[model samples]
Target chain A: MIEFRMPSLGADMEAGTLREWKVKPGDTVERGDIIADVETMKGIIEIEVFDAGVVEQLLVKEDEKVPVGTVMALIRPAGETAAPKPAERHVYETFKSIVNVKEEIPPVPAPAHEGLRASPLARRIAAENHLDLTTVQGSGEGGAITREDVEKAIAERDIRLKPRPAEPAPTPAASTENIRMAVAAAMSKSNREIPHYYLETSIDMSKALAWLAGANRQRPVAKRLLPVVLLIKATAKALREFPDLNAVWENGLQRKAEINIGFVISLRTGGLIVPAIRNADKKSPDDLMETLTDLIPRARALKLRSSELSESTITLTSLGDDGADAVFGVIYPPQVAIVGFGGIREQPVAENGLIGVRPVLRATLAGDHRATDGLTGSRFLAALQQLLQQPETL
Target chain B: MTEADIKTTIFQLLKRIAPDTEPSTLGPTDNIRDTLGIDSFDALQFIIALNEKLGIEIPEQDYGKTGTLEQLIAYIKTKER
Candidate 1:
């Protein structure tokens, strides 16, 4: 017997409401059959199966929310004399449905495929409104649909479209207010309650930067390494030695783990987006650079599908504007620490009893005192500057 | 606009938002919010006011430490500058 589990629709989204069930118990289902619909963070998505089998039980009922790995249904071989090989094959098979249902009025009823059947009106309305009927929790007998169900689905769908109304400019305010609310609550608490201490350091990147320029001239367009990438790499490596900065302050206590770095990329329209590069501490500076440059453009455009917006524990904000020498960044919430990168400016400085114009960046570390102290934070920043100073060892 | 002009305008707006507000004795040193108890919800109200008063799209990312009147003025001043 094969257990048909609720599919993982997004990276950070763990569970979803079972909007509806297209197939029922004892229904003969085939490979690629629409088994049930689940409502995830993105929207309603149709759930399908890859193995032809007999439906023995529906573990989750309509309108019930279940975790990503929760079993929603059970499937067995098509024939009475069944084999276990088909079930095994489907277990390892992972495929995602990318159908965007936009026509709210519904389309010609999609054939039930096997024994499943839906009203032509319900199908057409679903296709027109872009509602995935799999998610509609049918109140009718044998899990059939009713007119009220379609209206309810539309009301729920209307929430995302709420900001797109008569006024265009205020809509951005509506959208951005959500983000500000989250940010303000955090900064206020950090400033008002949490004991925070800030430390600043400067990094000299002449040698490593010269190497980057030469390497970029020889590398392909997508393969070039940027300075921000090297900074992330150095920060990650240093985090390994200074585990205290990677800790989180929660429940009046400190919790430590390997930190993921969120790179804050500004969108052209005004908003800023943070995308996390997971387990970056172990990756080389060059590799970190490549990932940062690649992920930033995608994230900034809001092109990230549900799965792309995964979880991250820490972040890095860079003000690499063309002419600016330095910029400060605010910390993202629930994160105990955030590192800022100023524009690498050329300045004269004395080193080893001699002074020369060198490329440098003013780095700032704002940390929560509950998790880290000024000494630990300073040492961490010092180690980070040291790593950026020498890239050949990384 | 001059830096002083921007500061004056922010102060004027902040003054109107908090009528019970005392004459702002603090300058760049004072927290933009502490003088008025401007919590997160107040920040949204301020953004709405700024949008109406300034004809700008003040993104949330551009706001975080916008706690001090100077910081708010700095943000508005920089946007125009």
Candidate 2:
């Protein structure tokens, strides 16, 4: 078995946004055939197969951004198990640690005769109810034990399965909520606590618009100039010079490094998610556009894997014409800064000592004051200003 | 120390680290904010301070659950065990 990893797009790139999967799992492929399209820091790159046989499994799906060395797909010569052998990377557990208890509990050993392969949680539910899992057949995918199986077992019998009268329903024992619920709690806490200082700067967008218009005229309509792509390009340039802005404030420690960027997208059903653009500070405008557009939808669906959500140094939030010129964004905690991109509007502004109407857009940077001072903020904004001014370079 | 002793130690630790916070209102069941009001940023600071004071590491991954005092106590006990 061979593994295909997310190749670094450029020299400075530590990761690439998994933009789109051109091929699905179990697809046959040849060497040099385009397997997936990855949006690298440089541009949207075609992930061509080096050795061809069968794409046994896609370790990553389209729109999931991953680190450079992360295995995105695995290929087998003919037939091989996609399941990463447990020996290679079982959840390494210390005997006891605070972090361990909260993580996914280990899967319990299965009962051989029962033939009811149950996850740890399902087995616990069954044991708690005194329902014989052996009598109940699994209806889940691939004969896996599901909550429904236990429920069915309970229903098929006429016996009352309630716990002893003295136990008192475990009193909603542990008061444990899912991790998603924890995220909600964090959001509410952020809104209530963070004294978010919003600095909105409307940049002259005439150059970007003109440059994009001309660039689009040269390229296909399917790939046109979008503001986000341009913003990525411009922000990348700004972050390159002011890397301090790209930081995380962890337990009295400010982790200042890579200029990864996270952008928000609202889901079709409900709620919002922020999927990050890995190493945006290095990606070209076209590449940034490709990464942002693809990953935003995946993020909204909560389909982004753990890899995608992890390791972002900074983030961006945009309301996209939902409100006025500026959006005061909440800093995605741990991250030092979040930039908000508001809708572009035509406004009169002074450019090169000349007052004129130009397409301008509001860009706000909310930074952790402890990490990035106003001067560093000024440098980032100034660098951004300098980048936007050079539409010719983009 | 027993799990209950560790919980009490944590409750005491919280007060020392977050000087502005008075956790006398805190209980095993009470939410962190309901007991002693803490916003998200404040919560982050509190976690950092708690870890530093205890000389225990609370990785960023665990901070989500450890935000509340009740949860934090549970987390520390799990670690001590």
Candidate 3:
């Protein structure tokens, strides 16, 4: 029996609440089939199964907050027979002991709080903040105090108990705070663990932008291509020449075949998610724009698929039209490099002994020093610039 | 579809695409993007919905002409004719 555990969606996700299971015992699941909806710091992420098998048992119940790597279910592989009940129990107990035995034992509901119906996440958050559960009111189904309720109480307490400082207050929204915490943890881990080398180049985007404008003039607004699409396409094309930069570094540098470029999209509410446009190099500029247009809305709505969340080989972040001229990004863990595109601006350009005003974009590369060198990164940038110069090709 | 029928269908489609948007607040001259806060992606979905529901092929070039409620209705009406 193969143990299906709660996956670490990102570096920061420690535990997740299983919101709902899409499958049950005896249901056959494919490798990439979404088996459950897991609520993490990222939001409701559809969890995909990696193994093709018949689910033998569902170990965790819906709405239980389980730590990362906690076994959520047992799957019997296609050829393998169902293990006898006694033997399965023996294996399960041994496995649980091997992987945090204490977590395997569910928290027994306290007798004093017999009628209290708090979510596991709420309980954990309440304990962390030293809040009394009885005093806090529940807004969830049947008077259950959710994570949001605990966070609300914490925010209120902070305002009432302490003298206000001049500093801007952090967002009191529980989900937003959770997202910020997750991002912070991931960024911290990335900074601590990854030795990063940064390189940047300003590419004259005059030709690319001109071409895009001309192209867009011909198409309807709905079918028009954005400048960002060209940037993504160029970046993906450049990865072909500098494959080392398009890789994930675990034990060693592992090169990915498909050039899936994850674009960092900031949400309107706050926080950001990097969902990839798969096989970006293979797609035309128009196709990439269509994909991006579809992606951004769904991403903001928190409706991204499991593969979209997990399959990025490299990341590209473009600060929209009003952003700063340059951005040095932190590399998301697993992926070795992150490409940042600052806002395109009209700048003075001197080319072939002639100085003229041209639209330019600042492209910065933050690469894992362990996986690639500065020379490799520079070459990648050169290719990207060359591709942008030849906009038609992209 | 009649002009009134087209308007109702478009409203239904818009509601489906952006349920939170108040249809009554929108006017003929109001820009859908500005009024509804719908982005290019949402607009593309809207176009797709129109195509599926009305069986009209809106060329990419004409997308610019369909920004307002009046513009969209006129564009669809012209295409249908």
Q: Worst lDDT window (10 residues) for model 2 chain B?
A: B37-46
- Measured as a fraction from 0 to 1, the native contacts recovered by model 2 come to 0.00
Which ranges in model 1 have alpha carbons more than 4 Å from their true place? A1-189, A252-256, A305-310, A321-324, B1-81
List of clashing residue pairs for candidate 3? A219-B61, A220-B60, A220-B61, A221-B64
What is the TM-score of candidate 1?
A: 0.47
Question: What TM-score does structure 2 among the candidates reach?
Answer: 0.46
Q: Give candidate 3 regions above 4 Å deviation.
A: A1-15, A19-39, A43-59, A66-178, B1-81
| lDDT tens digits by residue: candidate 2, B27-66 | 6667775356443323434555555556566654465676
Predicted candidate 2 versus true structure: per-residue lDDT over A299-379, tens digit per residue: 533456545665567777665533368887777666667888887788888868999988888888887776767777767
Which one wins on lDDT? 3
Candidate 3: tens digits of C-alpha lDDT, residues A1-394: 5567676644455777778999999999887787888776665667666567788778777776777766577777766664522221112221211110001222222224568788888887876654556657889999988999989987875553342233222233655666676667667767878899999999999889889879976875457676789999999999999999988886799999999998888754567778889999999998898798788878766667866877889999988565789999998887899999998899999989999999889999999999999999999999899999999988
Docking class of 2: incorrect
Assess chain B of each prediction and give its TM-score: 0.75, 0.64, 0.94
* Leading candidate by DockQ: 3
The local lDDT score (0 to 100) that residue A314 gets in candidate 2 is: 74
Superior by lDDT: candidate 1 or candidate 2: 1
